[model samples]
Target: MGIVTSLLPFSIRCEPDGDVLCAHLAKGNRQIDELREQPPTSVLFHGPQGYVSPSWYATKREHGRVVPTWNFVVVQVWGTPTIRDDVQWLREQIEELTNAAEKGFRMPWKVADAPEDFIQAQMKGIVGLEIPVSRIEGKRKLSQNQPDRNQAGVIAGLRETGQEALADAVAEGRRQPDDFSLAK
Candidate 1:
């Protein structure tokens, strides 16, 4: 409950392979309905993102005017999530997550200083999640369907727009097959 709220932002990758999901409000005491929580084992997270122009889509070149499309990266982890009621563990997890998230921020939230009534009330809303992951699916749909030239162009555009990682991921995505084979 405490750690996650106090720690600065940290990337929580699903086990070994899934992509990093977006930041979650780690207040252990936050309500379930108020959270966008998923099954503990569900590996899902996304961070900063932006829209990708239809101009980047490989299918766009043929059409003079095409609908705009977005390019983004997603990580999915499929697994069962377990909730923990241990107060100490919940507080520790919260604290860890919080410290990891708030490194740069001047004003950080603390669990200790929070009103006991308010905090206690928040307890029911929060429960620790134990996600034992099973399968991982990572997708970075940048623009792999296009020719090398077009891909290069898209990558350049993403980099120019300060989306280098996405550009690289998308560029590489074009070459990768959906299913893995013994030989690369």
Candidate 2:
């Protein structure tokens, strides 16, 4: 499978259903057109990422040889797309997506927030997509190449810059060395 398109307009929301990964798109979305024409495709999700300065390395003062790099987490999913144009399916997909995205809110929004007729009219403009996932690849690049002391220094620098999330990610990576791997 090759890239159908990147940076598609809508934020792609996907969930696993049995062996398949389901995604939702609008009726006129370019991805929908591409998926219809070419079913084989990939969906990539980029998680937290940050720049790591050479100064953050504990070894920088020793040899002054360290170079800047980046740390990140990413996931790639490959599959063949199957379009779902059913009105009921689109409604259900919209409701589920809305619910999941709004879960953190004090009072989450629901599809029922709008009038039934209004929602029905809106649902007509969308479509559902089901991809039977063939493979999945994930990577977590969080200063794993550095020694323990250097990694700690990087984490400290990150926390100083109010990047606690990235710092925590690096710390977590250090803790679970065997869990996160680039290998399939």
lDDT of 1 by residue, 39-140 (tens): 343444553345666575454666655555566667555555445577776666666676666677888776777777786677656556554555666666
Q: Where does candidate 1 have its weakest 10-residue lDDT segment?
A: 1-10
User: Relative to the unseen true structure, what is the C-alpha lDDT of residue 164 in candidate 2, on a scale of 0 to 100?
Assistant: 91
lDDT of 2 by residue, 2-70 (tens): 454645322344445535656577687767777776466777777778999999887998898899999
TM-score of 1: 0.57
